[model samples]
Target chain A: MSLLGGGIFKGMAVTLRNFVGSYFYKDRLTTNDYSWRPSDKLPQHAGEYPKEEGEQLRDTTTVTNYSRNFPMLLHDGSEPMDTIRCVACQICERECPPQCIYIEKSTEKKENAGGKPQFYPAKFDIDVSVCMSCQICVEVCPFDAIVMNSQFELSTPDRFGGLLLRRDDLLKSNDYYHNIHPEEAAARDKRIAEEKAAKEAKKKAAAEAARKKAEEKAKADAEASEGTPDIQEDAE
Target chain B: MSLELIRDILVATVPLLLIFPTLFAFTTWLERKALARIQNRIGPNKVGVPLTRYGGRFSLFGLGQPMADGIKMLFKENIVPRDADRLFHLLAPILALIPAMLVLCFLPIDFPWINNIQDSVKAFMLDGAVIFFFAITGLNTLAVFMAGWASRNKYSLLGGMRAIAQMVSYEIPLVLSAVIVVMMVGSLNAAEIANAQAGWNWFIFTPWGLAAFIIFFIAALAETNRSPFDLPEAESEIIAGYFTEYSGFKFALFFLGEYIAMFAISGLAVTLFLGGGAGPGVAALPWLSVIWFLVKIFALIAVMIWLRGTLPRLRVDQLMGFAWKFLLPLSILNIFIAGSALHLLAGGRLAGLDEKQPILRQLMEGANPLVVAGLWIGALLILYVAANGLNQLSRAKVRPREYKYAE
Candidate 1:
C-alpha cells in the first residue's frame, strides 16, 4: 500500500524479467560472444565461396566493423613476386606521433618501370609498446603500404622482443585485410583497378603518337632522296 | 562411548557434515551464476574442466572453482595485524562457524509421515529446538563482536556494533513470528510442530501464517546479514566489516559460516511453515522426504538470491527501523490474530483434527476450511487498513520542499 517498498518490488520485477528473458530471448542476452569462428550463413556475398542450405547465420557484415588500432605492413602481389608495399618513403615515420616506427633503406637497388633503381626498406621495426594506436601511420602512408590491423590480442610476456614487431611480423596478406575490413579492402581494390586501367590507356596513346612521327620521317627521307637525284641529272 | 552408540551418532551426523559443506559450496556457485544471469552476463564458466578435451570438444564449467579456492586458501599465508589481539583474532572465525554448525543440528529433517516411527534417525532432538536454534544463531553476534574488537580497526569496530544492533533487533521479530506456529502446535518440539501441519494443513495456507512467514523471512534475511540487510559488511560503507583483519583461510571460514547460516535458517523456515517433508508419496517412499525437503530449501535460497540481485543494501537507520518499527509489530499482531482465529474457529482444537488420524480423516475434518478462510480474510482486511493508516501517519510527518526560480 505504501510507496516506500514499491520501488524495491519494481526493481525485483525487472531483475526477474531479465533472469527469465536471458534464457529464452537471444536479444536479451547481453554477453558479447568473443568467439572468432564466423557462422556459415554470415551475410557473405559471392566472394570466392558458395553457401550451403539454411546455415545458422549472423549478419556480421552489416554490424559495426572492428576498429584496427595497430598498423601493419601490406604484402602486395602473390607468392614469388610478392613485395612489401613500403618503399622506405619515411612519410609514416615522420608523421608517427609517438616515433615508434623505424625504417632503413636498402643498400642494394631494384629496377623500377623506368629502368632506374629504387630502394626498398632493408629494416623495418615497430616498437609497439610505444605505439599509441592512433592510426597516424596508416593515414600517412602514401603508397597504401601501411594499414591498421584489427588483431588486438597483442599481449606479450617479453618486454623487448615480443613488443618490438619486425617487418615480417607486421606483414599481412591482402586476403587477411579483406576478411577483417571488407568495405575498405573492396574500395582499395577498385582504386587499384582504375589506376591500372589509366596506366594502360596512357601507354597506348604514347605508342600511337610514336608511330605517326616515324611515318612522317620516312616520307621526308624519300622526298630528300628524290631531290638529290634531280640535282644530279641537272648537273649532268 | 559404547560401539553401538558411537555407530548411531555417526549415522546421524556423517551425512550432515558431508552434505552441508558441499551444498554450501554449490550454493555459492549457483548464486554467482544466477546473479550473473540476472545482470545479463556469463558467470564463472572458464575455471574448471569436466573432462578431457576430446575431438576438440569439452563440457567444462567452473565446477572445480570452489575446490580450487579451498586449496588456494589452505596454501595462503594467514596474516594477522601487528596490533591485533592475536588470540581472539585467531579464534573469531572459528567461533563464527561453531554456532552455524550447531544450528544445523536442531533442524528436524525427513521425519516420515505414515510410519509411526516416533524416533526416526535424526541428528539431535531438543524439545525447544525452535528456541535453541535462535539462541545458537544469536551467538554468531558475539563472534562478529570478537572479530571486530580484536582487529583494532575502526571499520571493524563499526561493523561489529552494527552486527550486534541488527542481529539483536531482527531476532525479536524472527522469534516472535515462529512463536505463532509454536502456539498453534502447543509444543516446543520441532517434530511435533511439523506433525501438527501434516497433509493439506500446512500453516502457509492460512492468512496469519502467511503474514508470519513473510515477517519471519524478512527478519531472517537481516539476521543472516544477507544483502539489503547486510549493512555490517557493506563494502562501500565498511571495508570487510568484522572480518577486516582476517585473511586467507580465516576469511574462508567466515564466508563458509555466513553461507551455511543462510541455508540453515532457510531450512528452519521450511520445517516451521512448509510442513517439513510431508508431501504426497513421501510417506510411502520415505527417501522422497529428503528430496522434498531439499527442494523447498533450494526454492527459499533462490528467493534469497533474487532479493540479493534485485535490492540494494538498506542504510543503517532504515535497517534498524524496519526490523523494530515494522516487522516486530507485524509479527506480534500476526501471533495475536493466529491465536484468536484458532480459538474462535475449530473450537480451540489444538491438535488440528488429531495427528494420529489417517490422511483422509484429517482432510475431511481438519479445522473447517470455510470458517478458517473467513477468519483469515477478516484478519487480512484489518491488516490492510492498519498498514495504510501507518503509511499516511509516516508521510504526514515529512515537510515538502519549495523551489524558487532566479530571474
Candidate 2:
C-alpha cells in the first residue's frame, strides 16, 4: 500500500526475467548464432534470418520483403531468348519523380514472332544518389520490368562513379525475384502464362480459317474442270 | 631493507598485482555479457576465439576481449591538449587509482585453515579500517577535480564539479548506513566486522540491517559513478566527462580505477551485510572463504549491471534531491531505530546479552522469532507510510495532479 521502493523492485524483476528468459524463450533474444555448420533453425546459411514477425528472434535476423532500397530490372528465365520484361515503353523513365532514370530506347530493328519491332533499353541508368526509393518507378511500370531490391549494402568509396547504376548492374533473373518475393513472382508467372496461351489460341484459329479457304478453292477448280457451276454462290 | 621484510613486501604486492588486473579484466567481461543479456542480445563471443577456420562451430568464444582492449589501448596515441595543465592531467588518473587499490589492503578476503599464517591470509588489516576506507575513497573527489580542471574544457570542468557534489552528498548516507552496521557490530576493524557475522548471521536477514543495506547499496551506486547516478560522465550530455582529453593507457587507467572502486565498494558492502567469506563449509575448510568472497562480490556486481540495464540515468537535480532529502533522512532515521531497537530487544540494556549470539538468535530467545520478525516488519511498514506522508506534505499545495483529471 505504501508503494515505497516498489517501482525499483518491479524494474529489477523485469530485467532479471528478461535475462533468464533470453536463454529459454527463443523469441526474447534477437541474437544470431552465426555458426559455421548448418543448424536446424537455419540449414541453408550459417546465419539464418527470419522473414516474418512473431517468429523466434534467437539465432536469427529478420529480412522484410517490403524494405525497398534500390531499383532492379527483372529478366524472364526461360530458354533461347531470356526476355527482358521492359518493352522500353519509357513509362518508369517518365514517371520517376527524381528524374534519376535515364533510358535510351533501342534503335536497331529486331522483330518478334508477330513481326512487331520490339524495343529494348539500349542504355538504362539509375543514379541512386538522386533516387529516393519511393517505389513509384516500380508501381508505374506496366510491364513489371522494375522491382525494388532489398540489398541495402550499396556503400562505395567512389561516390559519383559507383552510385550511377547501368542496365547491367540493375539486371536480376526472375529466379532471384522468386527467391525474395515468392508470392509476387507466382502471380506474375501465372499472368504471363495466360497471355502466352491466349496468343497461341488466336494464331491457331487464324491458321485453321486460311487452310479451309484453300481447300474450298481447290474443290471449286475441280468442279469447273468437270463443267459444273460457280463458287461465288457459296456465301449464303 | 632486511631479507625478511623484502619477502613480506613481495608476498603482499606480488599476488595483488596479478589479482587486480585479472579482476578488472573479468569484471569488464561479466559487465558486457550481463548487460547484453539484459538488453536481449549476444555480446563478446567472438573476440577470444583462437581460430576462425570453423567459424562458430569450433572457434573459441570472445573471452580475450579485455586483453584485446588493453593491447589496443597500448598502441593508441596519448593526446594532451595544447592549453591544458599537463602535470595534473598526467597525474590525475594515477592519483585516482591509488586510493582504490589502497582500500583492498583493508579487506580480509580469505580466512585460512593454517592457524600460524592466519594474519597473512588477508592483504593487511588496519585498527580502524572503516574510517580509513571512507577517508581514502573520499580523495577520489580531488582526483576527479584535478582531471576535470586540468583538461581545460568546460564540459570536463562541469563533470568534475558534479562528481564532487554527488560524491560529497552521497557520502553522508553511505557512511550513515555503514555506521549502523558498525553500531551493531561495535568494531572499526573490517575483519572483526566480518567475523561478527558468522554462518547465516548475515545482517541482511534482520529488518534494520536490510534497510541499511538498501541505503548503502544506493549510495554505493552514486559513489562509484554507476548509471542512474553517473551524471559526471553522462555521455549524452558531456563527452567522456573529466577524462575527455585523455587517450591511450591514461584513459584506461581512469577506467581501471572505476572498476576497482566498484569491486572495493561491493566488497565493503559484502563485509558489512552479506557475511563476508562466511558460508556453511567455511568452518571446516577455511579455503572456501576465497570462493565465498568472490561469489558474493560477483553477485553484487551482477546486481549493479542489472540496475544499469534497467534504470535510466537520474537527472542532476533529481539525483541531488534524492540524496539530500530522501536517502539522507532515511539513513539517519535507520541508525536511530537500529540503536533503540537493539536496546529494547536486549531488555533495555545492551551490555548483558551473550556477545557470541547473532542478533537474530538473541531476539528469538528474548521473544518468539515469529513475534520479533512480525514486530520489526510492522515497524518498517509504518516507517514507509510515514515517509510517504511526509513527502506529500512537503510538496507545494498545488491540488494533487489527480484533481486536474477530475476537472
Candidate 3:
C-alpha cells in the first residue's frame, strides 16, 4: 500500500520549489507588469490609467487577435465619419438578437469611401451591457462596415449611459482594426477588393456583348436593303 | 487595582496589542507575495513608494500595499442589508475579535518589557490555562454563527451552519491531540506545559507527540477555517460564507480576528508540541526566547499559507469523515500509547523520580540510555503500525477511482 498523505507532502514540495524558483527564474513568471512595457505597445485606452510621460496607452492585457467582445464600425481613412463604410442598411440592427444595436439612417446621402453617395447612419448606438458578443452583427453586416473589436476591458460604473456606446466611440480606424485583428482585417480587405474587381469585370463583359449585338443588327439591316434592290432591278 | 499592579498589567498586555497586530499586517503582505510566487505570478507590486508614477525609480516591492489596503478598507462604505438584524450584525464582528484577542493572553511567551519576570509569568499562568484557552477559542464559532445568522442571507445561513458543523467535529480531535501533551505534562497549566519541554525536550520528539502534533495542526487548520478545511468560506459556492454580507471596516475586523486566532492557535501548538520558546542559545540571551517564540509561530503560519496554496478544499463529507473517522480515533489511541510509554519509561533510575516532574526530565535524570532509545523505537513502530491499520480499515470501501478517458 502507498503511504497515506504522501501526495500532500509531494504537492507541498512542488509548490515550495515553484515558490523559490519563481524568485530566481524570470521565465517562471507568466505575466509581467504592463506598466514596464514600452509606450508604443501600450493600448489606446491606457491614458485612463496612471502612466508616465508619453505613456498615453490603454491596458493591453488579455488583448489578442482571436479575442472579440462587441461590434465596432470600421472606417478606411483618418476621418472616421467621412470615410465610414456603413450605408445604414439596418441589417445588423435588425438581425441583432438582443436588439441592442440602434441605428438611424441619415435623410441626406453622403459620399462614402467608394465615392458613392450613400445613406450613412445618423445615430449609431450599441448597448454593450445587453450585447452577448455573439458576433452575429459582424456576420450579418453586408458592407463590411461592422466587425468585432478585441478590447474586452469594457467594465463601466454607469450601466445605461456608460455602456451604451455612441457613434463616435463605435467608429474605429481600419488601421486600429488591423492592429487588433490583423488576419481578419486582411482577409476582409482582400474579399472586398476581389468583389470590386469582379463587379468591374462583369460590367465590362456586359458592355462588350451589347456593342456586338448592335453591330450584328446593323449588318442584317444592310443585307436586307441590298437584297430588295436586286429584286427591283430584275423586275425592270 | 494598585498603581504598580496597573503598570504591571499594562506592561504585560500592551506589547501583545502592539506586536501581534503589526505581525498580522506583515503576515497579510507575506501571504499574498508567497502565494503569488508559488503560482508564478507577481503579486501586489504596483502600490509602493512611487516617487514618480511610471518612473520605476524605487518601487519597494509593494511593501506599502498593506498600508494602502488598510486605508482603502477604512474609506469603504459599511453596507448593511435592509432586512438584517442590525444589533447582532454589529455585535458579531466585535464578538469575533474579543475571543481571538482574549486567547492571546494564554500563550506562555515571555516578553522582555516586563522587568520582573515573576509578575509577567503570573499574568499568563492559570490553573486551567489550556482548558480556558480552549473554552475561549470555542466562542469564535459563536461569532461565526452570529455573523452567519444575523445576515439573513441564505448563503450566510448556510455558511454559518457549516462553520458550526466543521468546528464542532474538528474540536474533538483538536482537544484529544492536545490531551496527549497535557497527559504527558500531568498538568493543564500552559506555563507548566511549556516548561516541561525545556531545551530540546520538545514533546514532538516523542512518537505520540509527533502523531498528536500532526493531528493538532490539521485540526487547527480546520478550527481557523483555513484552506483544505475552508468549507464554510467556500468562495465559489457560498460566496464568502457568513461574512458575505459584511463589508468595510467590519470585514477588516473579521480578517484581523481570523489572523489573530491563527497566531493564538499556532502559539498553542508551539507550547504543546514544538517546545514553547525552547530554541538553542536561550540561556545566553533570555530575550531571544520571545524572538524564537514569534519565529516558531510564524513558521506554523507560513506552513498554513503554503498548505493553503497547495491543497484544494476538502469536500464537506470528507472533511467531517477525516476528523471523526481518522483523526479522532487515532488521537484517542495516541493518548493511551503515550500513557503506556510514559509508564514504561518510568523504570530503573527514573523509578524514584517525582511524578509531578515532566516525563522527559525524569528520563533525562539518568534513566538507562539504552532503555530510552528502545522505547523511542518501540513507540514509533507501535504508533505507525496502528495508524496504518486504521488507515486500511477506514479506507476499505473507498475504492480507487477508475478513469475512462485514458489508461
lDDT of 1 by residue, B10-96 (tens): 666677777899998888889988999999877766556533443122324566667767888888999999999999999999999
Per-residue alpha-carbon lDDT of model 3 for B118-187, expressed as tens digits? 4544656887999998999999999999999999999999999999999999999999999988887878
Taking all chains together, each candidate's TM-score versus the true structure is 0.80, 0.81, 0.81
DockQ for model 1 equals 0.49
Q: What is the Cα-based lDDT of residue B140 in candidate 1?
A: 97
CAPRI docking class of candidate 3: medium
Candidate 2 residue pairs that clash: B45-B62, B48-B62
- Each model's iRMS: 1.7, 1.1, 1.0
Task: For model 3, name the residue pairs that clash.
Answer: A43-A58, A45-A58, A46-A57, A46-A58
What range of 10 consecutive residues in model 1 chain A has the weakest lDDT sum? A227-236
Q: Write the per-residue lDDT of candidate 2 for residues B1-407, one digit (tens) a residue.
A: 56755666666656666787799998898888888889888778867543454343332456777777888999999999999999999999999898998888777776342233335434446768999999999999999999999999998999999999999999999999999888777777888788888888888887788988988999999999998899998888998789788899999999999998998899999999999899979989889987898889889998889889998888888788888888888888888888777766767546666665445355545665665776588758856765676556544362424534554
**C-alpha lDDT (0 to 100) for residue A179 of candidate 2:** 72
Q: What is the TM-score of chain B in candidate 1?
A: 0.89
Tens digits of lDDT, candidate 3, A1-236: 66777788999999999999997887887564655444555443422233565644342432355667788899999888899999999999899999999999999999988888999999999999999999999988889999988666666779899999999999998998888788788999999999989988887777666556655655565576655322111110
Winner by DockQ = 3
